[model samples]
Target: MIERDPLAPSRWSAEYRTGEFDEPFPWKPVLGVLGIVLVIVFAHLELQSKRIDELHTAINARLGGELEPLRGRFTARLSTLRAWLELREIDGPKMRAADLDFETIRSGGLLSVRRKRSAPGGGSSIELDSDEFGECLGVPSTSIARIQRRLAEFTPELRDEIDRTDHFLTLRGMQDQLDRRIDALLPELSLAIEARFLLLSEEDAEARELMLLLVDLESGQEKLRMRVPYEGRLLTARVMLDETTRAKSPGSIALPTELPKGASDCAAASTLREAIDGRHSIGEPMPEGGEHAAE
Candidate 1:
């Protein structure tokens, strides 16, 4: 390093210096300015973040207020729809049952009038097996008592279904109780055999059912009590069966020497060559024509 005199006189306006910093750089002023700039930038960023959060909160609040009523209405509508579906579910089986009952009622008259055999009074009726019920003619109370005794073996609920007038049932006592298949009563409610037994009644609805016969569709098994007679011309057979179906079906009577052609249920048709001179119980066999009763 060169030393210069402190009192020397300056002669030029421009001075050229070949010397630079001989000690460490001065850093305090630069650091102070940089710190001020950093503080300003950080404060600006913090303010922007706070404003952005407040804007988001305001937007969310406005949207929630607008949608609250819509949400409530939607919830109520959904609840109403669910309730309606539930009600329909509850009524579906009932409606189906009612429809089936209506159909049964509509065809009930035709069903009752379906006569495979003719009655003495020319009304609708069925003819029973002769050997089983030939003695039921001219005496009804005995047969009725016997049938009632058999019916006693059944539950009162099932006995209540035997209401149709002239509805017939041939009880075999071989099938299980009627209540056992009672659940299938509706689905299998059909009549195919009316020539065996007769269930007599006076009224339709308020009438008491004294007899019932049910035949299973799948098993061909019978489910009722008692047997009956099926035979004879309207003229002779009806005389023997007086007051059974309807009061007296005979007119200008003849004892019926020979049953009408193709007619076989005539009580007088016995090969014994005589009219009804003796009374025989349905359980007894006649001395004529090998006429035996069925169990």
Candidate 2:
């Protein structure tokens, strides 16, 4: 290259600069980033799918094999509790009609675990059956659940009954701690309970064994809840339904059905108000299978 000053045309007060040249874009880095983003998105979706499947499996297991049956057992126990208190019917399918009797009106599910309390101070523990563990965990688990607590919140009568039952148990069980005047009433209550047994009708006895059963833990739940009517207030409930001669009446609700198979979830007693909602102007259609309970 030679430096030479040759024939220059001069322009006044203008600076010289070069223009920008066009070049191919940097596609590789951009494509790598896009591919990484797609991979991340796909990975997130796969993780979500796996979580959903696990949830479904857990729910099914809870419903079918382990949890639900224990819940049903515990519900049946409430009926047992009711009988112990000398309240009304136990509609375990077998108790259906034939008596839609006065007991039927007081009808519902009850469960009992009958093993003499070893006289309060005796260190005797009842040997639990394999299913007993299921019952223990299931009741309290569902007891505080949203559906059940809502049921309690909705029914003041139920809350009252629970309080009443607890009160009765407290008074009766702790007679020594009671005031003198209230203690005197216990004898009269016993007499009243005895009279109820004598007054119980034959037909009423046939359905859910209108009396409470007194037995040991070895007797098993099947024996405790057996539909054998008794003379005094006894724990007798139909564990299995004799569906053959079952008479159909909406008023005569079945144990397993009306309860949506969950009694702690429903009610022992329903008044005229509960049976029908009068607030609604028009009648609504009935659902299939009838009285389907909350899941």
Q: Largest lDDT belongs to which candidate?
A: 2
lDDT of each: 0.29, 0.30
Q: Which stretches of candidate 2 lie over 4 Å from their true place?
A: 1-23, 87-295
For residues 1-295, write the lDDT of model 1, one tens digit per residue. Answer: 3445556775664666554214444589889999999999999888766655554444334324433333345345334323211221110110011111222222331111111234332333443211212232221111222322332454444333322112112221212334243322312122211122222211111221112221111222221221223233254433434666766554656554644322332232232111122222222322322221121
Report the number of the highest-TM-score candidate. 2
Q: How accurate is candidate 1 locally (lDDT)?
A: 0.29
- Residue-pair clashes per candidate, as listed? 9, 17
The true-versus-predicted C-alpha distance at residue 234 of model 2, in Å, is: 36
Error of 2 at 223 (Å): 18
Q: What TM-score does prediction 1 earn?
A: 0.21
